[model samples]
Target chain A: MNSKTAIKFSVLLLLFVLSCALSLLFGGSETMHLSDITSQDFIFWQIRFPKTITAIIAGSALAAAGLILQIIFRNPLAGPYVLGISSGASLMVALSILAGNSFHVFSDFFIGKSFIVVSAISGSFLVTLLILLISKKVNSNVILLLIGLMFSQICGAIQTALEYFSDPNSLKSFVIWGMGSLANTTNKDLLLFVPLAVLCLASLLFFIKPINALLLGQNYAQNIGINFKQSRFYLILISSVLTGLTTAFCGPIAFVGIAVPILSRMIFKTSKQQIHLLSTVLLGSTILLFADALCNSLLLQVSLPINMITTFIGAPLVIYLMFKNKHW
Target chain B: MKGEAMISIKNARLGYKKSGAEISVLKNIGLDFYAGDVIGIVGLNGVGKSTLLKTLCGLLPPLDGEVRIEGELMTQIALSELAKKVAIVLTEKIGGFNLTTFDVVAAGQMPYTNSFNRLEKKHKEIIKAAIEVCGLKEHQFKLINELSDGLFQKTIIAKALAQQTPILLLDEPSAFLDYASKHDLFLLLKKLAIKENKCVLVSSHDLDLLLKYCSKLLVIEEKLAHLISVDEAKTDAAFLRIGGGFI
Candidate 1:
């Protein structure tokens, strides 16, 4: 690594550690003192620990997913939500909560517990599968992106229709989820998310060579012994799992997936997949923790949504990248 | 040609099918490509020159018939095994990458690396040789995206050379190059084919340059394919009729 990369990595590492500490220190009704351990510490431990870990997991997962999708598609705009994946999961969650219909409605036999997470994951996977099928048939990248946007719009329409008929109480709950929050998840949810995120990250590590090959373009990657279809399938599978998990625990936090990887690339000054992947994970966690802090500290009566903060930061970065670099 | 045929395609059919319409590009093409031969393929745009190269390199499956290497069908061979036998340079421009010119060339060794993407000592040696051969030693540490188009093209060629495969394929390698860069690339390709005993096939719009440099020629015309020795290609009645129009 060059000096520039080294400095960026160190700064990110420091931010990650500081954010973890800050997340543990401040939040909930009462803040805990650092010097003394008390019953309030247990409340802070129970409420804040899982919430903070969930944010970290969500951040790392989304950022890594976005990086992989962008590199594979060779489009900086490609992300977990860009291809209708988050919309699919969100729509499924909306249907389950707003319509009061159980997942068993889709299948004759189903277990009731963990149904929300399962349904969300399956919904995202189904949409990812559809995108993959379309990609195989269509050779144009712009057309694929347009199709993905259309899919997102269709899912949004369905979500809106469901919300229109929902009872007010269920609608309130669904709306809160839609705003995106890390506070609602429990330790059990963290147990579910942490391992899944780590496993997906591990699988992505195995794909470094293929991702590097992809930077040369698809035909060149294919010529270099990568089975394009198989590699793409694996990439989509991992990205979907990561996206699905984050959406399940924290709702669809927008733009973190898209923005973090691009930010990491600018900071590191390299497009190599390995460096981008690592930086994305760390940078994502740092941004999410900071956003969560701002959401907690600045809001008086109503806490600002995580999605709102991410969109605020992400939109300008997108504009800057587009205007400054024509080739990216 | 001192050894057995390295690549053989028999009774191949090339075409595109869209919305229930089938368009045949090339039909029943049979050919044997040998080591130490620099073959030039000349054809009009959309004449299936790229499709033929893709099929030979196993990028596309032949609609009909078979491609064989060392007496085995191409489809049955693993992708990694196929990569060891051939390498290709494409016409598309690459995006921004902070890779040194040497790192760009070292990517050719990906097929031989273990699953972790680590390069062995021998791989490093091959990469060094590739960089030296391309005359890019001074620019080895320069970022790939910063190089001019001519140097970038040379870097891609150096990457292919690093693969050290028995056969190499290039699609319009000199399409965007200056006259001097184009001349130097073709000369280097000819030298590599003869001195290293590798089979090289290239598609080109520069018919005059192809005629002067290539040992053999494959011409695609009217949905048919013809392979002829360069000497015979010069005197054939068909050649005189087409003349400079082939360019």
Candidate 2:
């Protein structure tokens, strides 16, 4: 790494740490003080600490997943959101948590009662498998993206049907989940969330070389001894796991995937995947932490949806990227 | 040719497998490429020039006959081992932006890298040597997306050279270069084949330049590939046999 990029990485990493600290310090109400927490460390561990960790994991996983798909598909606009993987995850959540005996699979129909993460993974995996099969048939990248949009629409309809049949409390929970929050995970849920997120992120790390090779083009990547099909399979596996698990634990937080990598590349001024990966991780974590801070600060009495904060920040950036289409 | 055969294609039928049936493009081809030969494939448009190149590089499987590379069957060779023996540059446009020319060339060192793709000092040296040989020293730090057509083309060639493969396959490699750059590319390929003792296969539409610089000429006509010497290609009936006078 050059001195300048190294300096940039250090600065971004520092900002990430600061974001983590800030996310842990406060939430919708007063600052989470050690002195104020007299009842067995009440709000800090229950709310802020796990939420901060959730922000870090969700942000980095989604961003890295987005970056990998973008490189592999050679489309700057591709992401888990646009590709329907997130919606598939969201659909599983809806079916498990909100459906409530409307469409029982068997005696144990509520996927949420046991292994919600696994159910979400199966949903995301199925969608990913369908997309992969479709991509093989489609010749154009644009058409592939359109098919992804189709998946998103179909999943959206199914989730809506489940919501329509749901009871009030279940509907309320579904609404809150759709709004996207990092504070949904209890300490009990973290037992399930952390290990899976770490595994997905590690898989993303292993793809650094193939991702870099993919930037040259698929045929070139294969020529350089990268098994293009296999790498793509792994990419789908990793990305689906990340998107699925994050959506399971922390709701479908959108736009961090598309926006963070774009900003990282624009700021770093390089397409090198290794540099971009590092930049995306740090920047992604920082952005989510910043958004969480914003969510806490803006309402003060009530926590706004994280999706609102991220989209308010991300959509404009994507629109700006669209105008600067040449770089994209 | 003093060296052993680098690649042997025996009665190979090449085609695309589309929709459960094979759409054959070329059939019954027998060819051997030596270590020190620059073989140029010349054909009209849509005449399987790129297909033949793809089949040779194992990107496409032959429909019937087997291809052996360095005495191993091409299909049976491991991907990493095949990478060490053969390299290819396609005409496809690359996507990533702001990649330095140095980065593009260093990608050739991929097979030699550790699991994390970190290059060793020796691998870095090979990449540097390739950049130097391709005359990209001044432009080495420039982003490939910002490079001129000629410089971009050089970056692709330099990448192939850094691969250290014995056989190089280029599909319409000179298609985008200007006349001067085209000649420079051909001369470099010629030098690499003769001095470096690498087998080079090139497919191009520049028959005149190709015939002059290449040691041999390959013509694809009527689903058959014919390999002939440049002197044999220089004969009076050669252009007529290609289906018309030169355009």
Candidate 3:
């Protein structure tokens, strides 16, 4: 790495840490004074600490996922949320819950939430497989993008229709899940989220060579002896896994999945995935932590949904990028 | 250097593989490429000039007969070995990448690199020579997407050069380039063929200019590839009948 990149990385790391600190110390209540160990210290350690880590993990996973999708699809605007892969997970989880209720399974079940999470992940994997199959048949990125949007619409409609007939308590919880939150993940869930994100990110890093060659498109990549189908398959699998875990724990926290990678590209002034991937992790976490901090601070204790915060920031950027460059 | 065939096609049929059936694009192609030969294939749009080259490069397998490289069937050679034998420059634009010209050129070494794709000193030297040969020293660090069509064409050619293969194929390499850049590109190809002892096959719609530099002409007429002397190609009965102007 050059000196400039190293310096930029260091600055981004510092900002990430600062954002995490803010999210931990000051959220939903008075900022805990580190010097004074009061009852509030428990809130800091137990609640805000896990929430901060949750924000960082979810944000970084989405960021890397976005970068991978963009590279494999050869579209700068691709991401887990935008491609409807997360909605697929959400659909599966919702379906599992409704099925359990109809069978009276939830009444006797204590550990069924884990079953929902497992089903959600498999739903994500199935959708990913379907998308890859279609992508292989169609060479156009725009066509695949339209197909993903259609998948989102179909999946979202099914979920909403299922919600219409569900019980009041189930409906309310499902609605809350759709809004997305970083505060909901318990320390127990952290054991699941952290390792999965690390493994997927390792897969992302390992794919640097194929992804770099893919910049010239699949024909060129294939001609150069990189097995194109295998490369794309592994990348899609890793991207979906990351998206699935985040959707399972934190819900579909939109925008960060699509926007942070672009923001990193803008900041670094380069489009190399190796640099963009690394920068996406640091900058994605920094932005999400800051957004969570804003949620805690801006509205004065009544925190906005993390999804709402990201969409508010991200939607306009997507519009601006589409306008500024017809390349997308 | 101009002795033996680098690649030879024997009655190969070119076509598109569709669901449950194949669409025949072109048929009955027989040709041999040798070092120090600049063979230019010319045809009208939609006449499958690109298809013939794609078939030759093994991007699409021949529907019939065999394509042999150094007496071994092309189907028998692994993709890695075939890549080392032939390299092609495509005209398609790969935009939205933040890659520099140097980085794009460096990707040419992928087939030879280690799993991690680290450029050894030898690889780096070859990549440097390719950039220099394409006269891209001033724009090596420029982002590829920011370059003009002519420069982008050069950058893609430079990438093909870095592959260090014995046979190079380019499909309409000068299509988007200006006249001056077009001449420069062909001049570079001619030099590569004669001096570097590489076999180069280029397909172009610019028949007059192509005929000027090409040692032999392959004319696509009525879905058939015709290898004729540059002198005879100008007035061949089929060439006159097809009557593609600007020849």
Candidate 4:
């Protein structure tokens, strides 16, 4: 690592710390001033703490997923949302809601209860499997990306059909979940998400050599002794799990999955997977916290949906990057 | 010491199958490459020169027969293990054009690094030495995208050198280079094979450069392959028929 990279990493770390501090202090009827220790403090500790922790976990997971996907596909635009993994999870959640199921029940009995969590996990994995199968058949990267987009549209059509058949109460619940929120998550949810995310991220870090070699191209990577199939499978598996977990917890948080990695590359001026992963993690958390803070500060009557804020901030960045240069 | 074969292929048959149709590119080909030998492969555009290079380096599996590295089957060896024995420099431009020259060369150390992806002291020393040998120390910190095509070619060659593999395969290393750059590249390859004791195999369209610099030539004609000593290649009727007139 060079001094510039070290300095940039340190700055991102500092910003992450500040974001965590700010998130802890503010949110959902819990204002903790330095002067008073009241029920509000307890509320902040209990309610806001879990939510903030969930956001951090989700942000890191999604960003890492995006980074991995981009490297694997060799396309800058590849991500959980664009590749239909989010839609897969969303369609599962929508199905569960229509069946009058609770999300927490799925989290609890994910291992055994042949119902909600199992269905969601299988749905996500199935989409990833289809993608892998298609990638093997169709060697063109652009065609793979288009296939993913078509899958996303197909999932959206199913979701709409389900909504059409559901009653008002179930529809309302599904709509709220679709809007994406990090709030109301319990410690058990954290137990389910954090470990999986960490494991996936660790595996991703382990495959950095192959991913870097891929920057040169597949033939070159293989020539350098990187097993092309093994590395590609590992990366896809890790990315699917990361994206699946985040979409399970927070409903399809739009654009953060696609945007954070791009932003990190721009700011850090490097596309090395290691640097991209680290910078994406820190920048992802900061973006989420900052957007959540904005949502709270602006909407006095109602808590604005988290996805709306993320989309608002993220879309502009995507547009700017798209138009900036062809080389990147 | 003078004629020990570093790479040996026995009855190698390489090709691809599609729709139950097998197209044979190389049939029953066999050759031995020794250290300090600069070998050149020349053929028309579609004649499997690149495929042969890839197969010899163990990037592609042979349809039949085996490639042996020091008497070990290439397929039986682990990828990282195989990587330590042979390195290839391709003609494709690297995707991360924003990387510095040093970073691009350091990427060669990937097979050598441990879990944290940190290079060992020995790995770093090798990378530095490769940079110096490639004459790229002045451009070490320069962004790869900003460099001339000649520098980019050298940077890739430097990466292959840093790999420290005994056998090096280059696919059209001089394809996009200017006259001066091509001259410099051939000079560098000759020195690398002669002084550094590397068995180098390069594919090129410049027959003149290949004839002057390489000790042996592998000519692919009409989908058949032949390996001939460069001196005999001059008077051989088969070589004369294929060599034609232009470089």
**What are the runs in model 3 whose C-alpha is more than 4 Å off?**
A35-42, A100-114, A126-147, A323-328, B1-4, B242-247
Give the lDDT of residue B116 in candidate 4.
52
- lDDT for each residue of candidate 2 in B1-247, tens digit (9 for 90 to 100): 3656889999889988998899999999898888889999987788898888888778998999989998789999888778888899888766455678998899999988976888889999999999998889999998777788778888898999999999999989898898888998899999999998999999988888887899988888878888888888867354446636663
How far in Å is the alpha carbon of A57 misplaced in model 3?
Answer: 1.4
| TM-score head-to-head 2 vs 3, winner | 2
**lDDT string, candidate 3, A200-293, tens digits:** 8877778778888888897788777777778887887788778888888888888887888777777786645788888999888888899898
lDDT score for residue B148 of model 4: 87
lDDT of 2 by residue, A1-328 (tens): 7899988888898898888877877754778765655556767768777888888888988898888777867778778877888889889878766444456543552344345677677788788788877877787867987998999899989888888988888888888888889988777777667787787777677888888888887788888988888988888888888888888887888889888888888889876788888788789889999999889988789888999999999989988987885555
The per-model DockQ list reads 0.62, 0.66, 0.45, 0.54
Q: Hey, what RMSD does candidate 4 come out at?
A: 3.0
Pick the winner on DockQ between candidates 3 and 4.
4
- Estimate the lDDT of model 2: 0.83
Question: After aligning candidate 3 to the native by TM-score, how far in Å is the CA of A325 from where it should be?
Answer: 5.7
Error of 3 at B96 (Å): 1.3
**Candidate ranking (lDDT, best to worst):** 2, 3, 1, 4
Per TM-score, what order, best first? 2, 1, 4, 3
Q: Where is model 4 chain A poorest over a 10-residue stretch in terms of lDDT? A: A110-119
